[model samples]
Target: MSSLSPTSPPPAQSHALLSYPSPSILLVTLNRPLAMNALPFQAHWDLSELWSWFDDSPTLLVAILTGAGSAFCAGQDLKEVQANRLQPPSQPYLKGRPPSGFGGMSQRKGRKPIIAAVNGVAFGGGFEMCLNCDIVIASPRAQFALPEARRGLYASAGGLPRLVHGAGIQIASEIALTGRSISAEEGIRWLFVNRISKSQETLLEEAITLGREIARLSPDAVIATRGGLRDAHEMAGLEETWARTKERYEKKLYGAPNMLEGLAAFMGKREPKWVVSNL
Candidate 1:
């Protein structure tokens, strides 16, 4: 894909390193490697702001999230939580993370897609975030676990239900209750992980390739198609979700400029130029 025009970009942040690896792809690397990329309370808000910008940014279509070192994310920072226990109840730290859940992902239904390039350990809250992401590409060394139960904390960040949806009740229960570590191979077996790369060296490259495939298509179509898929996964019934998806995207997508361009390009046997999606 060709480079795109820049829009108002995200501001600098303390816990994250954000860069545009490609014109349509936003790469966010968790910078707290010493802490195993553990998200303290405030990092949640910081990332929430970033993700909001990515969703709204006309130049960006996909986001790739990975950790700086060998851990994608260790989940929430327990030490910070423990320290906050000593603070006064009136303090803001006591209020907990925003309604978006851990790292603004565990419970997010964002507009754009986020692909998790699982480079290493994804434990607790880290694993939770992956459960909600649109795609997950794991490294050979990648391991996922819901060890929060063993730590006297349930995987309360929406991972439990989503796990059951992907891995079934018995499997989800066994993993959650035992807190056993699941390797990348086993993750694919349980149908949680999309696939593992050949090695850690090529993990990010593989993820970016897949992101580009999505980015190359009509932006409006991709958004609406993704929304429909998510609705089927998260909403009530098949018919109801289909009806809702039609009402939400059918007219707008079929009538958009890109819609005409796509059809004309197809008939003319040429490449279609997509406009920034307003959907």
Candidate 2:
């Protein structure tokens, strides 16, 4: 697969940093460390495009999202919002908003898995992004919250629904209503976090390691598993659900090229050269 060289291009002003840290893993770091990586309007647009690029890029198999410096993200930029409101652009629709939802990944159906490496505070939209990720790795000092209610704002970026589904109705309600912060430990207890790193520096490391593990497997199998898990939640009837799951496996996994590669790799004691295919 092709890779991005260090000299390819400098970081875009709208982005903190976007780089390929590994062969198949892309690291998207929220760069505004000084302002806690707040998502200004431009940042949102950048994220929207970035997510689409990752989804279409054949070389990139997985991505790890994190924040620069100490904090993960402080949510939206209130100042930017206020300024935009004051300006009141003549063409409101042209103001550039992410169609994929806030931070690009929330409230949308995407195939590839994203891992949120939460290093510090993940508030408001930040927390919502964490909820949208396929996996979440948090630092011991990380804090998660949806403080929108306190500010007389609501979490409209799939935060409410994702939180409810990921953390349960009760816990989600408590977090949404109170607008208080929860520590990483509490997040683990609520099953929101997949793993806890000892420190902020290790958060991305852990996430990349996990992403690499996923990348090593058949991309088709990973996509199938992800799709099945997503579909499993909305399904009810046990027999029908099992049958559907089996059907997907038969169509997507069984007799697929990747399936043959996986079996051959195991038997031959060599890494399989897998191909990307929905079939």
Candidate number achieving the greatest lDDT relative to the actual structure:
1
Pairs of residues clashing in candidate 2:
none
Worst window of 10 by summed lDDT in candidate 2? 1-10
The alpha-carbon deviation from the true structure for residue 187 of candidate 2, after best TM-score superposition, in angstroms, is 0.1
Model 2 residue runs over 4 Å out of place are: 1-13, 94-96, 234-249
* lDDT score at residue 210, model 2, on the 0-100 scale: 90
* Reference-based TM-score of each model: 0.96, 0.89
Query: Scored by CA lDDT, what does every candidate get?
Result: 0.89, 0.80
Supply the TM-score for candidate 1: 0.96
lDDT of 2 by residue, 1-279 (tens): 223333233325475687777777888999989899888777776677777777767666788999998889889888877877778756564344577777777765677789999999999989988888889999998999999989989988888987887778999999999999999999999988988997766777888889889888787787778777766755767777778877866676888888998899999999888876554
Model 1 lDDT tens row, 244-274: 9999999999979889989999999999988
Task: Give the range of the ten consecutive residues with the poorest summed lDDT in model 1.
Answer: 86-95
